[model samples]
Target chain A: MTSETTPKSLRTIPREKAFYFFTSIGNYTGLSASSLKDFLEKINQVNIKSLEFHLNRGDFEKWLNEVLEDKKLAEQLGRLQRSNLSGDILRSQLYEIVSRHYKELTTRAAFSM
Target chain B: MKLKNNTIALDATDYKILEALREDARQTYTDIGEQLGIAHSTVYDRIKRMEQYGIIKQYTTIVDAEKAGAKKITAIMTIYTEPKESEKVAEKLCKAPEILEVYTSLSEELQIIAKITAENQESLHTFIANSIAPLPGVLRIRTSILTKKFKENAFSIVSDPKKITFIKETRNIERRETV
Candidate 1:
């Protein structure tokens, strides 16, 4: 979900706490996202290599859980981790989870207002 | 690690880290990463996943019981039980703290093999006579005291950690339809 539905304390993180993408060990793609919205965009732009690297290392879930304080996304990704999905299948599923969450948050924000 | 057909695939890095840790568990993440040429954070992450899967079961220090003045005697017990009661007997043995390990051999006759730990000879005999003999379907019993020491190799003992490629094992549970 986006920050709109997320608690203010966990809505958006500072630069130092942002999620960083890596192509592999010691291989940074120079891509980082400081918010869920930014993350959704960056996920599309970033290489599958970077996604695989971060997914294998569970970096995405760690960022979601530790920085964004979003357990829902973290848990959704955790289940995906077990699903043995990869490549575009993985990327699309990854995008779908976040996009669905982003939409969910946006809708909640709209209704709450 | 790569994903192939919805499974999380493990790479050499995970094994190398395990090999390093198996050689020495106290090695810091930084040390392993430096030797393996991966990011230290990656090393940490891999090990944590291994732990979650129970792949890395435990890190323990082997203690010399005799040198430490502990009256520990190891006994190898072979129990011949009725075929129908073999598993039951083995499971019962597992409940005893004194029973270190329980194994079943499917021979012509079902045999329960157990590694038993005891304080002294008298207790060992007492346990076998009292607890073991009284168990149902026990046809006979055999015991051998390990009188000497030998190699106990913790390393080099077991699987190749998924033939050098690890995969998280998941089982599908389905309900059977019964009339």
Candidate 2:
């Protein structure tokens, strides 16, 4: 099978199990993503406040580890969180890490299928 | 009194004062005190202390560079520098007017990310080839020219000070002997 058409088990979660973005404890940012690819995209448009909020709350790591089952990416993000980065720097760096991981994971999943 | 690390402790009142300043810096101390239910003199004293300690660096307007008739090409220049020379490269880059923002990202080694602005594509190319590449410890650079910006600095985000860790101010502190 082509990498794009690789088996479902080799892929990230579907739309049903998407992670949501939030600005505060109960304030949702009206954004959600199912797969790593989708999360990678939505993160850019989401407010830095949401990114700061989620990073501090361990929400992204939790969702990545639990819903996406990608502990490596989660841990990588965890390291960034501890670095005391905030604002657009956080967004850009977070994007760089997530995109790199997404590429590696997708390639690995394709081969493992 | 300054702490051992050249840092200052930010209490709830400090956070509230910061929040008020963030909302409208031009507002009078009396106005802030009225809103926060503190005396204007208290607000004045707190603000003065904050400024002296180097927390409130400067009160400046956040200009929309693009809208201000700046026909400059912006590039997200990500450069990987030798671990030991990271601080030197970053300090030099910080002094460059074209390089607006400089940040160190978490990677295998520290990576320098700079938001740069140039007059045109030719200038942008020249800048990378001439200015960036010659940096002694620079390993490689990846420049992503931003075609459009959906968002820039979101100043409206009122950060919670409780979660925010206060740290050392880079400015030289006038250390006074605490009695």
Candidate 3:
């Protein structure tokens, strides 16, 4: 019998708040993982500056395709990827795309309060 | 005391005294003087001078958050705003009770990092959603929920003179090794 695997494309309303949706995205997109989760749960906290440092070095296109599974976003990011933009420019681009995605995901009828 | 031509200077002794007090703010001037091999009156004078020069802001206690019933939840938010509106955004963030600290970055993206705390997760979410997101000039916000707190160093001018020297030597060796 084959084990069932959940598709990463399927967007589900997180049981927690919208903030957690970003954290889950971070985990899925390889920004961070369970290794840091336990420490944060117990007593350690992640720094935003450090997260920015890691995201600046991460593969945005891969994150959009593999984790978010958004073809449109992946295509947009892919174009920017070829431009060879500086880290700051790339970050702003990614932020805009992700912000749009977040708005769409949260606006779904299921998530409406 | 004047060092050379009209330069007010802090000597090694002053630094040592400052270091001792940093380790224990409640440390008596007599004890600090004894440890640093200076007179109590000298310690008092140096502290007074430092205070006058605005080097020493205030002596305060660092309370344990967990023990104080204040460790509810914490998150780091990365905020984006209009480049010219960053100062206004930062000021607004500072006025919010949930926000503990705010930092502005000098980048094309009007980036601000805010540390927020709340009594519970739901309240924290409400505060962000109802309070922060609608604020004028806030373009986008990305939040990271802190899972652990590995270190939070107290504000100090210098940790230890010996350690600072050692760390410098270690960094020099590391640089040489890499090269």
Best by TM-score: 3
Model 1: how far residue B156 lies from native, Å = 2.5
Residue A113 deviation, candidate 1, in Å? 96
lDDT rank order:
1, 2, 3
lDDT of each: 0.76, 0.76, 0.61
For residues B1-179, write the lDDT of model 2, one tens digit per residue: 23557778776677788888987889999999998899999999999999998888889897777789888888887778889998999999999898989999978867889989899976875566556665667766667788977865435433454444332221223233332
Tens digits of per-residue lDDT for model 3 on B1-179? Answer: 33457445665677787788788989899999999888999999989888887677789888778889776888888888778788988998899888999999867776889999887765775576556655556666777888888988666655466866786689899999999
* DockQ winner, 2 or 3: 3
Over 4 Å off, model 3: A1-113, B1-9, B159-179
Candidate 1 steric clashes: 3
Candidate 2, residue B44: the lDDT equals: 96
Looking at model 3, the pairs that clash are A39-B148, A40-B147, A40-B148, A41-B147, A43-B148, A43-B149, A44-B148, A44-B149, A45-B148, A45-B149
lDDT (10s digit) by residue, model 1, range A1-113: 55455564236676656666656432334467888988988989988987877787677888788788889988998888888787998999999999998888767776776
Question: Model 3 — TM-score against the truth?
Answer: 0.53
List, for all models, the DockQ compared with the true complex.
0.00, 0.01, 0.03
